[model samples]
Target: DGYLATFDLDEYRAVKGGVAKKLYRYTNKRLWKRHRFTIGLRSLAEEKLGFKQGQFESELARSLAAPVAELQRFGIVCVIKQHGRMKQVHIAKKMKRKEAKEPSAPVPSLAKKLLDRGVDNAVELVQRFDAERIRDQIENFDDRTKNGNDVGPGWLRCAVENGYGFRKGFKPSRIVAEEQKVKSEKRRKAVADRAREDAELKTQQAADEEAFAEFLKFRNSLSENRRQELEDEALSKCSEFERNCVVKARRNDEIGMFHQLLWEQYIIPTLAED
Candidate 1:
């Protein structure tokens, strides 16, 4: 019978004094919907029989027949939704049963018997069933890919959410390593580019400093009177042109010195460390 049931783990724990620990227990509603029938049946069994679905023996099923039938007759459905370590079962129909016999205990109640076995049995069953099914689905995934069917993004996302694709194989670690390699390569390239730019600027600065030193040396070698005579002669050779060129050259030297001092005080130490 088609029915929907939502089972909440917290509520289950409050009743049973034990928690659901399977990875699949925390899966979202949409993923659980893939096995909606199984989930609903399990929830109903828990609710009506005070036994987890996996513990639903033939006798337990028989015990719950009346309640199941009543819901079925009323056209009400049960939906089960599981979150991590929690299960919730939503019943759509209201059965006309007396308050006294209306499943007096909470589903999977923490009576002595349930306390002894319920938690361990429920967790084991869920883990075993879910792991086997996930393994089969992964093995068959290649067939879908070969047929040009992309497993929708949602499918992959669900697998990741449920922790199915990794830990089983070394694939997740491999992917992480590859991503790290790419980032490392990008960082190296950026550092190289910056270094090249710094080298070019340094080379230009050194050339300017060397030329200025040579000019100063020549000027110092001459007597003051001889240097003045040479300046007057150069000015006389080309009046406006010489004056303009000399003025501009002096201005450039002043600007270059300012930049050189700034680099030495701030930029050079940082670049050298890198």
Candidate 2:
């Protein structure tokens, strides 16, 4: 038994950004037996790479650079070359020298599942098809194949070919789309909630500012004697320690500080009631 590591549809789909999918498809279709493939840059752009018409060679090369680098991370190497008026790309898979090894520890989960269903070439089948799709087919086969029905690998293969899971009114793509929609709705709701909270905070802040301004105006309109009486009433409500602090401020000739202390102790509370 030997383990072979290859990227399945899940890993391929998980790769994000910059024409990686196109690059993968192109390389995958062409580089199965051969290690290298050469294609016209213009043809690759228009056909496989999905670039728009009239794109210059420099632009295509620049765009291809990123995906080429990305594919390199997945063991594919690319070389771009210009020959007179023709620009071509060489796509190659990096090969490692094979050496003798010990027996594989255990079959992978997907292969094991295939084996349980009586597939002699479970490992080959796992490598050949999308793992998730295979798993889906296996589940569908299990559900449909009852005690009397055929529960063999042949039935499973037929189920996979016909896409029994999709035929049962549920598709993997549809599920993914629905999940994305739910996530998008949650994000939108979160943003709306944040905006509403911010607006409410600002409105309350404006109302508090207006009320404080009115309080200041009403106090200024009061006669000097009346204002002094109100200040004394406010000071009476203060604790002994607070009153001592106010006295110390007044003794230091800090008139602004003394007024602020009185406003906090008395005027602000009266304004709050109004």
Candidate 3:
């Protein structure tokens, strides 16, 4: 943490002087000032959600109940106008720079959305979110652009949500239907592929486990001196890849690479011993 602690006076000055004066001077202080929000809870609620204000004892109070309850659940507001316990809520928000504008967040990354949706299987993943369909929509968008073509239905939503491309028009229902069909096909394919991969992996793991068991039996049958001799022999016979893996595994306590090598077929008994 203190990499600079040993620096000499001249070296310290050389490092300290690296930052240019103009870069520091150009930063705008005025832009950092607090933003003023003029809209209050009463007006903003009514404007955004169509909430209405009326006498607490009147029939209008019934209409206000649900909207006010929803608004106050935001934690930033408390609507108590119903019980004649109405209190004013002042909203203060500063607009941010272009990159910082708080629009509804774009769909999260595939991994994040998958985890959040608890989608582990291909069917679940496809049903919850159609990644392949999104991809096809992107391709369609590209094809249309290349030919100087008009935007298709579902093009606008697809472009804005995923591709960051823009088109202005009402989305077509047919495009959505086409997207659903493509996703359905992809899910079926993905499920089959995943099943095949899992089967291959399990078969390989079973073979490895059987090989490891054989090695362990051989090791366990040996005397203490014989065991040490075998361990040293195994260590000596390690390939560059095996040695590197063992060393790294020992270095990293988080994962036991050395123990893994001792069981793996890669570090089996020597030819003479076998």
- The candidate that wins on lDDT is 2
Of the candidates shown, which would achieve the greatest TM-score relative to the real structure? 2
> What are the lDDT scores of the predictions, listed in order?
0.43, 0.70, 0.43
User: Root-mean-square deviation of each candidate, in angstroms?
Assistant: 20.7, 18.2, 29.0
> What TM-score against the true fold does each predicted structure earn?
0.26, 0.35, 0.29
Give the CA lDDT, 0 to 100, for residue 209 in model 1: 83
Better structure of 1 and 3 per TM-score = 3
Considering lDDT, which of the candidate structures 2 and 3 is the better prediction for this target? 2
For residue 268, what is the lDDT in candidate 2? 70
Tell me the spans in candidate 3 whose CA falls farther than 4 Å from its real position.
1-176, 237-269, 272-274
Candidate 2 has an lDDT of 0.70
Cα-based lDDT at residue 143, candidate 3: 58
Worst 10 residues of 2 by lDDT: 1-10
Per-residue accuracy of model 1 over 185-215 as CA lDDT, tens digit each: 9999999999999999999989988965765
- How many steric clashes does model 1 contain? 20
- Tell me the tens digit of each residue's lDDT in model 2 across 1-274: 2112333353364345758878886786677667898999889988887899898989999988888877775568889999889899988987732432222667788778876766555665677778777877776666556434434554565455445544454445546677999999999999999999999999998997776676567667889798777777777987777677777765885545456657766777796898
In the predicted model 2, the residue pairs found to clash are none
Off by over 4 Å in 2: 1-7, 96-274
